[model samples]
Target: MNLFKLFQDIEAVDGDATERLGYYSRRSLLRLGSKALAVSAPTVMASVLNEAYAQSSSVQDVLNYALTLEYLEDDYYQKGNAAANLIPAADKAIFTQIGKHETAHVALLRGALGSAAVAKPAFKYPAATFTDYQTFLLLAQAFEDTGVRAYKGQAGNLLGMDVLTTALQIHSVEARHASEVRRLRGLRGWVSATDEAPAPVYAGEAVTSQAGVDLVALTGKSADRVREAFDEPLDRAAVLAIAQPYL
Candidate 1:
């Protein structure tokens, strides 16, 4: 929750981060960061965040975009958790906890958007998505991975605002969900460049450099190791392409 370091990291990834963070200059962003750092009165912090997001039509669109994904995940987990024999008893707790997080995320994003929130759409899945454990695991892996990348892709759109902090927190949870799902599927906790089974979900993940720094060269690590160390963001168009089947 280091606000200053968070802003610095965002700028490192996307140099124009502050410019899009409520149209603020570096000075204004630092001032906001200082306020967020102080952890003063709750109302004062709330007012600052409201000012950052309440007036932006663009932020509303981002929230709605996020809501769609949450609704999809929430519905998926609800049906899975309710199914009599879908999830194995031993892993029921894991999925149940995951489902609750999704539901809470849906509520949080929906409340923020209020009237502007997008209505939940009917979710569709492959045959035996829940009835078969292996199928269920596969689909969960894909959904969770897509969710993580999708959130990271939206980070630049929500830079200096406190909402960005909120998004990052959710992003962290999504990543844990992805890692757990991947491990259940017998893969490592991280995505591999060769894991393109679900087509473009793992596509474009083979990069070796980030922020103009060659990670492999800098760290003296193998290319695959370097690739596994950093996550690649998926643009909205790419994420929607992957999400189309579920909506």
Candidate 2:
């Protein structure tokens, strides 16, 4: 349906990129006889919009992206939970809970998308990926942390109060998952400026300024604490690079 061309046309609209994209995404969805539902709701909506309107919208594009990541995470946790002697005895329940949460997220996103939902991609985890409990925890931390930032990065691109609110709700859950995973790994729940193994995920997160004020200078907080106080957003390219390994 020439979706890329539709996005290009959306980019040409006057105003900020976020506003333009949001407007076009909403307008296009409305043309399909649906209200802006949820950021994760896109598959069936995309199909209807594509057929009836002859074009796919940017909102559907965002939802498809979200669904892909959710599928990756859901599968990761499900595998980890089922792996033989992988998760430690004490931590098994925690992994179970986390796995359930991820499963629920996948279901919710899929339900929202209806028929337009993208099929889950085949994932390729290395042979030694989750063999060690510590290794599994580390990867879990990365996935959860990346998920939190990914949602934040796309907040502006979502349209409608309902859709934006739903995305934010999911974003908070991802942040909690990140914190829990960090705790399980015997690390601080919050990230510091020094932690930068995966550069794309933490890049620019060390900044101490907010609303033109130097937070460290004004509040006398340490740079690390300032960095922890706010989570930075990762652009789509950055997110994709971080997620590419498992896809």
Q: 148-239 in candidate 1: lDDT tens per residue?
A: 89999998987777778888999889999989988887888898766556877887888899999998889998998988888888989998
Task: Point to the candidate with the largest TM-score.
Answer: 1
lDDT of 2 by residue, 194-237 (tens): 65555666777887898889999999979888988988888899
Per-candidate TM equals: 0.78, 0.77
lDDT value, residue 242 of candidate 2: 90
Backbone clashes in model 2, listed as residue pairs: 42-113, 43-116, 43-117, 44-115, 44-116
Candidate 2, 159: how far from true, in Å? 4.5
Superposed by TM-score, candidate 1 places the C-alpha of residue 236 at a distance from the truth, in angstroms, of 0.6
